[model samples]
Target chain A: MREDRHVVSVRDIPETLDDSALIGHSLSEPETFAALFDRHADEIHRYAARRLGPELAEDVTAEVFLVAFRGRARYDRSWPDARPWLYGIATRVVSQHRRAERRRTHALSRMSVDRPATFDDRSADRVTAEQLQPRLARALTRLSAAERDLLLLVAWADLTYEDAALALGVPVGTVRSRLHRLRAKVRRALGGNDPFAEEPQHG
Target chain B: MDDEIRQFAEGRPPAPAYRPEARARARELLLAEARGGGRFRLPRFGWQAVAAFGVTVALVGGVAAALSGRPQEHLAAAAGATQSAAVAEPPAGDLEPRPGQFILVESDTMYGSMTMGRNGEESRHLYRTHRKIWQSVDGSADGLLLIEGREPRPWPGQRELPKDAEGRQSSLWTTLAACPGAPHRSDYTYLSTLPTDPAALRERLYTAADEKDVDRDERAFGAAGDLVRETYLPKAQRDALFEAVKGIPGTQVAEGVEDSAGRKGVALGRTAGGTLTQLIFDPATHMFLGERQTVVDERAGQAPEGSVVALTAQLKVSVADRLPDEAATAEPGGGCPSSAVPPTEQPTPAATLSPPENVTEGPEPAVTGTMTATPAAPPAVKRSPSESAPAVPESGVAATETVPAPPVAPTETAPEPAAPGAGS
Candidate 1:
């Protein structure tokens, strides 16, 4: 009865709380999820933007947070990290704009673009994404939607296989099977196992 | 993962930064939602102010679940939220009957009830009766209750029919009376004069129905069901009434259900203590077809599980100027006309009967084939105790009842484990 009496808002929540803790507390104070949004929104927005372009990304980002907040009650709290769950939600939201996603991939594959792939922490490798992106984009368009979601979460969102499973609400084995199917298709399309060789930029 | 694919996924497209405007607009939407935002699509008729408020309350509570793609979890939360809000409001969803002359609602009702006799024995009985009530829009009316008990049949093998067998009555029409304290002193005038504003009507009805001080929402829902079924209402008023009932704490809406008569409709339900009552309505027309009540948990004065405690199939509900031609005359008694009831079968003393099973009766199975198969052989459809249908197969008409069980009562049930059909 006490639980039914009041629904809490964000102001009552402490900033120091962890995501799962924030989610649990948000049950009483639904606004407490604002803290969760502030913690994870940037990364999810970047992921959506990369997949569906900037315009749809904004809508997808907002949808992800709202959906996560609404379904917080069903979230499994035993897991300490909320990122995987948020990414799972973002994956579903991004899924709705499938036409827009395919358009982005097809558009990218047609271009002869050049850009340095200096992912901040992996800078010592000193490789570029320009040479491989076009072919990779074509390969991505050929893969299944479920495969694409899994590969992108790991490769783009930087989630581990286990986290991807948690996000997708599937077992790690299923994630591995999707991964295997994706890589096999890419190999067939690219005509080689190591088609994405990161040639050292000899500057 | 392939490096090219990794770079493809890790690849950043040059897009603008996360805009503060999007974030701000989203927050505004969220806050508005939290504060119960959104305007109701106002209806053209009825009390505008109350209707708007009612619609707003309904939308703010109902819209989120509609929007959520994963409804399994969110719908429950929304229902919980709506129930608490409903409890705070005054009772609602009452309708005012049509204006002018006595609106005669003539119905053929097949009611199944549990009967307990002074012999410390309990039996379930189902009876069919033609109930006609001629009421002026205000509440004053005459009712004719024609129950065929036991009589000399015009043909062979039709003698001494069961109490609940379908039969026409020729008894006199008698004055109808309301239950004690029904709608502001059971006055027809008060019922017709009720405000169409759902909230106000609900509030007023809730107070009257809550006299026992227990199962408030259930009682209020019952009262609402009564008004909606027993009286006639216009379309707009009827819609307002359902919307009002939707606001009650335990009102559950079950879409795509079929009533016992095989007519499809939406079922609105509420459960109190251990009894679940459902009033089915034709969704397209919003007409009340029938209602069923089930005894959910084991409690005193309740029958076994899966027993349909009460069922009423409204054979027909039409507006007529007077009682049907055959049931027109009234005897001297203020109650039911004696001539209207069959003369041979004695009226079972009302005091010995359970509140529900006090209808009509006699002795012979008009169509009896004594067949004894598994009494609990599952019916063609699956049913929760709350969902109902004919309790027992109407005896001999079908091959299903292979054993020699007489078709006295139409009610069938999951047989009590020990008692193989009580050898009456």
Candidate 2:
């Protein structure tokens, strides 16, 4: 009976089958979690890589999915979108390697010290407000782990406060509060206000 | 601000490189464990036993605060019994403050964490945070928060304190009274108006947007914790909150919890998010003592086993007629200010209880950190294999390769995850 049905990859599962359905499917067929994996791995991996590094990013991304898979039995079917849940797992996974991430950030800043974004990627330099790449990396490193996570999730991961709350297991209010705090910190770190702020340039 | 950061981070030299090998390795390990049937099962019994023992001590503290001989049963009631009757009557016969006044709670919180600095230097440390809140019981929804931090005894890699222009250690005092971003007036009154009947309360809280999905009992308990922490409620409602909380499954009385001011009290412990959150109470008077969150199941959390993630112990909770100290500066209440804050996020016990129904899936693909919103286990659905197994292994290796066809097929439309779509 088991052999009669072919094992389908995650993509084959209908895109319409939101996260909860796939999770439900995974309950019967453990491999079904892979579909959930395929949907979000790239983003999760990117987030992790940005926080930590490519090496740990892969491991952290893998761990996030693995942990999610192992814990699928407890996943709330109520949350059809798995991004918050996956990111939450990814956060925990990243939190475990805090030192490594800090080191990597420092390394990145150091790596960029000689040739700022101005040298390597002119486009990136324009977008980042022309601050030396090291300064941006340093600013990130200057933040607490909690602040960094919130900032990057919003900045890099592009999660809203509500999604961040769901992912972090805190309340939307708390997310708002953290983001408010983070913005202040960012302003302070970047010599007052966002370096790439969009106000019209002065004469 | 976020856009700039995103742009800046993206502009850096190399884009995120996905690792096929790492994913493969993790996949292999998971598949092996999934098929192995008895791979790694997180050992919960050890923590539960410790929690039970610790709870006994905390409950004794609660009993003392309650000045009641009946807390042992209340303690037992917390063990997932769903004591519907307890909703009408708290286990302890404690007195409540007279209505129409301010209730001031002052306490110190200890947060232990491992810090990784910008230069990649990492170390473990402990810091103490102090808090004072003056919440009015009357419907105006007025409140005050005076929070500050004191450097704790140093551990390795602990950093120095950062102060404000006034030479004050990092401090925040916010006043609340129907201010836009301040405490919600409805949050208080809405919670007050909930049905007092335990079962009905469970239905009301659980059927709400996000609450509907998670384990009903835990969500209810978490919600109760939120209401208890955030605002000052009338005695009847307070009792109702506890009664509702007591009915949630998996709650047991933590015997004794010493408040930050070193006062003894009773506590209720619920484990989630890889940490055991103990809602401490005044043992003799049944008043709230701040809570203590300890890492119980570190396998999935940010800390190691037994680490004290954060704990708040209340020093003073008094029913006063007015703002305790109006002259003292408070953070502007209407809109959250863009002020420098101590880096750590204080865990507001009541904040966790808010409904997540308003949030919807948007174009942004990002994740926030949410520890628990576990869908209440459906009657037809099989509990996690580990939950059914009375004897979970040390590493929770119980996941098996063999599959059991779930007894019922889901007839779900597969709504967006953030759409407040009903999972059931």
Candidate 3:
């Protein structure tokens, strides 16, 4: 009878369970959802802040998690990770503030960067990037909201092509083609010079 | 990652880390939702909803009056008043405004306002304003709104007054334009045409243009409060409005609730998403006194439980013979800079007034002004016996237990209606 007992103590449930298991358990124990929030809230907040400045990001981040929690029952448990689903929801949430995002990018484009003396490769790279920010922001403003979303999910959120496709609910091929076209447009915007073209290539 | 993409990421301005307080607040709301039997309820009194409502109202026209109500002690009194065969009369005097006269309404109102700092921190405070408005008895002429900003009250958990709240003593006068097709809903001419039967009025209240995300019952209850708070209604219409309020499911009465000015009254309140909006009435005369909104659950509203986030005291409503000199000189589009106008009293754009979509929706609530006023024959004043009968039993238990008992309810049903309303 002691060997047959099936009750698991709270301590016995490992914290390392993947998101799918946590979300599955949360159906019976709703507090289990908080662990998911703790795992993803920082990255979600950072992604939202990068798009719409910090002030509006606070609201967007909160809304994203609430919407995710409410719709958690419908989540596909086949996926082991929750990042794609969260980023997908985040894409929609951030889209609601399209005007704010445009305003932010346009504001950045008009700002002049003051150059500083560089001491190392990292600082030099940073200085070069700062110099290119004006054109980069302007190029971002010119992209359609969909293109901007896909570009940023890969470029900023660091999603792989497959994950970007998952986040945007598109076929992976579409991600590759869109990125190819967007890179060309951004390269053109940078006066046909790629900032990293001169760097030593690494495998 | 592509080299160009890598540079793009590196060039991005650094985002500030999420504030711990904000994170905790969001967590608390989530936990509360989980504890609430795992059903998702739209956040009650969410800062975003309130801020959005304010912005929507501002874009549509100037600041509309805040929504209000109180709970159970008043239900018993209201029921007692309804039993008698005698027609209910206005408490002070004849509230009917004669044709060509203006209806002057004065009130002290406090509502929550939120502002974000440059660093992305949000601060909330209760902005108090003294508002005086005069509208023509008929909706033919423009109205005037004179709002004077008062000292703002600190919201619960506020450390110090935000810079946005400082030196807010300036007053501004804005002209409430009565465009060719847009009639003011609260004007006596429009209100007099409302259904006098409680059930019909209640139905009409429900069918108004729905505010996105607000529960229908809560919207109707808030609409009823708006109709009575800053406008004068005839005795019969006022009586019908009060009676109709009982038909709204989830209404609870609070025996003794105080308005902002310290006047004691019985309050009829309905709780939704954790905030209880109460409409207070003079217990003796049943005259609508004011409105109060209290956070009954801290988790949903992100405030201390029992915190009164909004309050209004109706000081006076009387007939006036003429407009002030300022009104005479006020142009249709120009009077005061918008910054000078209290955030609540910005002039409404004409598009919100007479849109075809609004006309089809139904009569607009006096505050949100989402519908057009249709002229109907005055409703019959005679109340049938059944209509006058108490809708809810005068049982003490029903009143006490219907909703979360407001934190202010005294143990001994104190004879004096003076229960200090919480967190005002």
Candidate 4:
């Protein structure tokens, strides 16, 4: 009986598991789509808040999923993971509200002198993040939009460069080149030993 | 370098949140669209049947007219007036063809939309562009173009490849040979023929790059001259066009009329080998303005192939040049002024296809001024929901809710005093 139930549950899943399929199913059935909303809404909201701050994030995060729902038909389904697809949509959604994003970035950069670097009791990571925020902000401002998207998607969203390329509709070669240029500039800004000279291994 | 940047930039912050109301509105609109059929779906079977019946009636009427052969006078009238620019130009239906060498420009817009499965979750893109074209008296051609804003990539046409070159498909080689003109940063020209010998063509291209003393017009002429001398013409189609225009007796001075671009020019239309052909020319200057020859296939459902159109001077001529040169130079074989343009800058003509403030489709007003505000823009871009729809019911309801309260307050107070006493 248990084995039968397990098979039934697995059968209920989509024949093809992909970004387009995940979103496509939701669009077809609103109640079913609410499950997706429950799954991704919080994370998407958090991401928007970090990029554009609380006020704009609320609008953009909602808009991203809504637009994704509308355009689900055109989504290429060959890739199984929907995360990169979401990131791509989010990138455009964020780019649309760039003025708001810039304002948020600028506000974060201009930290008050007495501001504490921790949420709750300070951790070492928090302290480093705070210290790095200003200089990193300046360096980010210097990069082109394409370069910024490539570098930051990998950084914040935990996407591989190949995934980032799919999100940006660019060649993998372009993503790699842009990331390289971005890394050198960022490293110089951080005044760090060349940490990136060590290559990353990918399967 | 790319890997290093990606590695170095790892572990940054996340993005922000979305507004609840905006999200709600999007959900509402999407639901409504889903309830209504998708905007671009084909008509139902009943509608198609009605359309077929209507077409039958129209065809019968057309056949009657064909049997009567009443349009011969119109043709004769046009031919009679073809004799003279020195003579006063005739009224409508005058078909005076001029043998003048004039450059022309033409632009075409094509749109493709598809919905694969049910639920109507579709995406659509509108592509609009203009081409600069130059044609000699003998039908030699050159075309230059700049794709405007947000133009999707083009569909590939039929291509022949050698066995060794099967995997190594080079856009650079095909684009270079497609058009007659030099590939300037501001423009890319399309060619119907490639030079018979590739090595010879490359050598000439290299040598021509050094010939900077030539004026824009002369350079264009030289390119066209070289193309005729060097490029292999597929003898079949060129011969047909030549044969079609060859026999019509007496020189016809093409009168000028307004073309699709709103520019006044003389025009001629002909059908050859399943191609609908039209040529526009400026009567005053005897300059060729544009040519559109499209072979449309209703069966294929879109303009798949065998359709051709050219609009331009030898080089691209734009209403305004907004894109940076580097953006243009990114194109293969782009002859951007290398000395003036920095190497890092890639020429991208993002502004080329931007819609003008006021748009016209042959005097029929498609979109009015107020309707074209932020609401008409694609939701992917920078427009707020409120800005898109300025009028909301909330403010209107609030105004009515406020108006009745103050006057009713005093009368309600007297009743309120009695109500507390009675209850006690």
Q: Best candidate per DockQ, number?
A: 3
What is the TM-score (0 to 1) of candidate 1?
0.38
Quote the positional error of residue B198 for candidate 1 in Å: 2.6
* Best candidate, TM-score: 3
Considering DockQ, which of the candidate structures 1 and 2 is the better prediction for this target? Answer: 2
Better of 2 and 3 by lDDT: 3
| RMSD to true structure for each model, in Å | 27.8, 24.7, 18.7, 26.8
**Correct interface contacts retained, every candidate:** 0.18, 0.18, 0.33, 0.18
Each candidate's chain A: what TM-score? 0.81, 0.83, 0.81, 0.76
**In candidate 4, which residue ranges exceed 4 Å CA deviation?**
A1-18, A26-31, A112-114, A117-124, A191-203, B1-11, B14-424
List model 4 lDDT by residue over B1-424, tens digit each: 4544543344244232345544544343333222221111111110000000000000000011111112322322432443232122211111110111111222322222121223433222222232222222112111122333222222223232212222211211101111111121111111222222434333323333222222322222223223321111222322322222222222123444333233445444444334444454434332333443445542242344553422211111111111123223433321211122233543323332223222122222112111212211122111111213322223323222112101111212222111111100
Question: Candidate 4 lDDT, tens digit per residue, A1-203?
Answer: 00000000111233334445655554333223433454566666766666777666765665666566655656676776766777898888888887776776676667642367534525665555555565556666767777777776787666897899998989889887777677777767655543322234342
Worst ten in a row by lDDT for model 1 chain A? A1-10
**Per-residue lDDT tens digits of candidate 1, residues B385-412?**
1112222334342332222222212112
lDDT of every model, 2 decimals? 0.49, 0.49, 0.58, 0.36
- Per-prediction DockQ comes to 0.08, 0.09, 0.16, 0.09
- Report the lDDT of model 3 for residue B366: 27
DockQ score for model 2: 0.09
| lDDT (Cα, 0-100) at A59 in candidate 3 | 72
- Candidate 2 retains true contacts at a fraction of 0.18
lDDT of prediction 4: 0.36
Best model per lDDT = 3
